[model samples]
Target chain A: MEATVKIFRFNPETDQKPHFETYTMPVESTDRVLDLLEYIKGNFDGTLSFRRSCAHGICGSDAMRINGRNYLACKALVKDVGLKIKVEPVLGLKVIKDLIVDMDPFFEHFRSVMPYFVNDEPPPAKERLQTIEERERFDDTTKCILCACCTTSCPSFWANQEYLGPAAMVNAHRFIFDSRDRAAAERLRILNDQFGVFRCHTIFNCTIACPREIEITQAIGELKNAISTGALE
Target chain B: MMQTRVVPQRGFNLDYIMFIFTRVSGLSIVLLALVGIILAMVMGARTQMDLGTLMRWTFFPNPNHVVNSDIPDVTLGWANAYWSTMQFLLIFFAFTHAANGLRMIVEDYVNRGVGQLLVRGFFFLLWLFMLITAIFVVLSS
Candidate 1:
């Protein structure tokens, strides 16, 4: 089947404004959207640029708006998005070039959440351990690839870029709920600010837009629950 | 693993206050509406008032408030008996009703990149305007 891929193009140095350039090419039903992008870049226009590390969707370097929804290009197949495809850079971020967004703000929010283990205690004789149930408590949030898909799709983030976004909260949730981590209090303090979990508004766009299918809204609700009730359960 | 049973409590902030306020306000609204409906029913609304009058009574309960004199000598109406309750109800409930309803619609339809920032800014100002105006009206009256 022939697929028409319209790519959002912009170069700050050259183009006065952003525009879309369309390419028609043959594609199989099983071919990934990344394949279509590669075809366009390889044959149609070498100047076209997009981020993609592992074409298998693990790297999460190619998250974009495909057909008005956030999805990983390498994960979305041609048949799923139909023949006529419209691709654009993810929303709520500064676009550097064609299909490339500045992810500094996103990473900054992630870092602010302290998305790491912080158990300041005498080193256990050997290593710390966790129960299966405790691990399962926050298992869902462990799959975040830092794609910014969920964060970019959030309307709250679009409205207020400082809202920390869903991806950061999910990363926070991962460590906050961990029975092995002791920084939950500090993280909760940060999240209690104006740009924290309270800004979520329960929109659920982050949950739907997540390519990994992580229950982003549920994780946020859990974070809110922990803050409100002061109980991790 | 660290002893992680309960996390820290949330500190005070407008957002946190409003977060809890939103939940409590929702329940208060239902309770207030129930009180209004029951009082209206008990006040012989079934026998004397039509469904429209009962609904108006349930909502504002001050059927003649719109036309009532600002400097009336004495409170003289079925709703006047419950004046204080109706006063508090009319102030906060109405504000939350309209503001939260608008928030729901805006959050539902105008989500994502399109019109998000514009709608959010517009709603915030509208809420602030409504709050200040309501306070002024209450204080002046």
Candidate 2:
């Protein structure tokens, strides 16, 4: 199948403004968008830059706008994108180069949630134990791979960059609902700010954009309910 | 790189407060509008009134129209009270919901920072103007 891939290209050092460049390539129906990008770089233009690790979509890199939807390029098959693929860097982030965005803002939000287990209780002899039910509590949110897809796709985050984006909230949900985590109170307090969980308006764009198929809106609703019902410490 | 730090405000978080208010006000508007429509329909049917007559009766209730009938007077009084209260609430919710919705739309197109703040401020001013005008109109009537 012959596919026309239109990608946004910009280099801050050389170009004053970003522009789109189209490349035509022979692609197999099974070929991922990432494969098309690679073909463009290797044969058409080496300057075309995009991030990709673990071409199977596990790395969460190579997330871009494919046909107006946020998706990991490695996971979006060429056949699904059809004859014309309009690829651009994810929205609401500074583009560093062609299809490459500065991920610091994304990571900053992720870090704000302290995406890690925290329990000050004296360690059990070996490791913390959790029942299957307890583990299932946050099983959905545990699938997040730090991809900016959900956050970038969110209109709330686009409005207020400070708004703790959906990815951050999902990570917070992971720890907030964990039965063994001791930092639920602190995390809840942190997320209770003006730019915190309250900023979400249930748009569900994040839910739809999620590559992991995580029910982000439902998790956010649970957070709101937890806060209102005083479920947090 | 966008800095991600919490700005600690001393009082209740406005976002949280507004988030709750928007939902509550939305529901209130829907309920009040439904009730208002039904009451209008009932009053219209009672008097065998047309749309223009119903509008006048609703907006400009003539006290003298409630002649000797105790039931008519009581029903008119109740309807007037309900209408006045709903008018006030509808204005408040309509303006608030519109302003908040506009804020979301602006945020999507405008970049975050001073631009967003300025746009939001302009929207706030517009909402305030509309609310005041609506209140004045409602109360005067």
Tens digits of lDDT, candidate 2, A1-233:
68898989999999999999988988789999998899898998998989998988799998999999999998999778898999999999989998999999889988998889887889999888877777788899999998889999998887778788999999999998887777776777778886788888899999999999999999988877666655632
Instruction: Indicate the worst ten consecutive residues by lDDT in candidate 1 chain A.
Output: A154-163
Return the TM-scores of chain A for each candidate in numbered order. 0.99, 0.97
Which residues of candidate 2, in runs, are more than 4 Å off? B1-12, B45-79, B100-136
Residue clash pairs of candidate 1? none
Q: For residue B5, give model 2's deviation from the true position in Å.
A: 27
Candidate 2: residue A100 Cα off by (Å): 0.5
lDDT of each: 0.83, 0.80
TM-score against truth, every candidate: 0.84, 0.84
Comparing to the true complex, what docking class would candidate 2 get?
Answer: incorrect
Instruction: Report how far off residue A4 is in candidate 1 (Å).
Output: 1.3
For residues A80-138, could you state the per-residue lDDT of candidate 1 as single tens digits?
Answer: 99999999999999999999999999999999999999987887888897888898999
**Model 1, DockQ value?**
0.41
Candidate 1 chain B has its poorest 10 consecutive residues by lDDT at B66-75
Error of 2 at A41 (Å): 1.3
On a 0 to 1 TM-score scale, where does candidate 2 land against the true structure? 0.84
